[model samples]
Target: MLSDIRPAIVSTILFTVLLGLVYPLAITGVAKLAFPYQAEGSLVRDSAGHVVGSALLAQPFAKDEYLHPRPSAAGNGYDPTSSGGSNYGPLSADLAKRIKGDAAALRQSTGHVQIPDDAITTSASGLDPDISPQYALLQVDRIAKARGAAADEVRALIQRNIQSPLFGFIGQPRVNVLMTNRALDLALPKGQPKRA
Candidate 1:
């Protein structure tokens, strides 16, 4: 029994040191070396070089002039630490009530009777940074009106920011809302302040 126990203890310690310590350290080192920007949380910066946000996370943009991300259930919107959806299943009265409310708001703002589901629903992660291209285009007119810019110019801005499917077909075409808003701010006429 003593001999068998000794081998088991040795193996346990060996694996603990190898997998619990060495493996994580080695992988972290490789990641830090290979993708320094991403290793630091993929933060985005403003033109003046101040850190604005992480490209990987979504932010709440409530202004009409800025495009919005899908509804978020994480701590009043975009709290990475509490990332999760409402968890309300289909046919749930609570879910229906929330969607009905959001759809009403979107219809009023976008002036469209039929808005896309994504426009009113939160993503499962509750922090998706991308919106479908269709949804982004749906807001072009509203944003243009809010900013007093021409709809065609705003459409052109959206077109310029459209990110193609990864490697030509991995995911649907989507727009990163924060990136698009930043571009709009930069292109806005002189003296216009960047919206928070």
Candidate 2:
């Protein structure tokens, strides 16, 4: 019995060290060495070299001058640590109410009677970093007017910033919210600083 227990304990310790510790460390090391930028969270920077945000999560922008991300089911909106969906069933009254409220808010803010569902709906992961291209275009007018820039210019900026789907088909095309906003800031008209 003593011999049996000793071998079992020793094997458990060895497996834990190898599988739990060594394997993870090795994988992490290789990832860092091969893809340092991605392994470090894909942080974005501003023209001033200040770290602004990550490409992985959305950031809220309630003002009219900036394009907005998809509605987040996270706390308040876009809370990274609280990443999750609203969990409302398709037939849930609560979901309907929320969508209606969001639509109304978008209409009021942008003065556009027709609101895209993507503008008001939260993605399943609650960390969506993109809006539908239609949704982004819809806000172009409002954002351009608010920023006192030509609509065409803003549209051009959006077009330039659009990211294609991974491997051409794995997922939908997306605009990384933080990267887009950073570009906006960098491309701001000579006199104006990009507003938050």
Predicted model with the maximum TM-score: 1
For model 2, the local distance difference test gives: 0.81
Clashes of each: 0, 0
Clashing pairs in 1: none
Minimal lDDT window, size 10, model 2: 187-196
lDDT of 1 at 171: 82
lDDT of each: 0.88, 0.81
Could you estimate the TM-score for every candidate?
A: 0.90, 0.86
Off by over 4 Å in 2: 1-8, 47-50, 194-196
lDDT of each residue in 12-104, candidate 1, tens digit only: 999999999999999899999999899989989877878889888999999888899999998778899899999988898999999999999
Can you give the lDDT of residue 159 in candidate 1? Answer: 88
lDDT (tens digit, per residue) of candidate 2 on 1-196: 8779988999999999999999999989999999998998887776677777788878887777778899889876788788889989999999999998989888887778887778888898788888877788888888788778888988999889887888999888767666776666567552465433
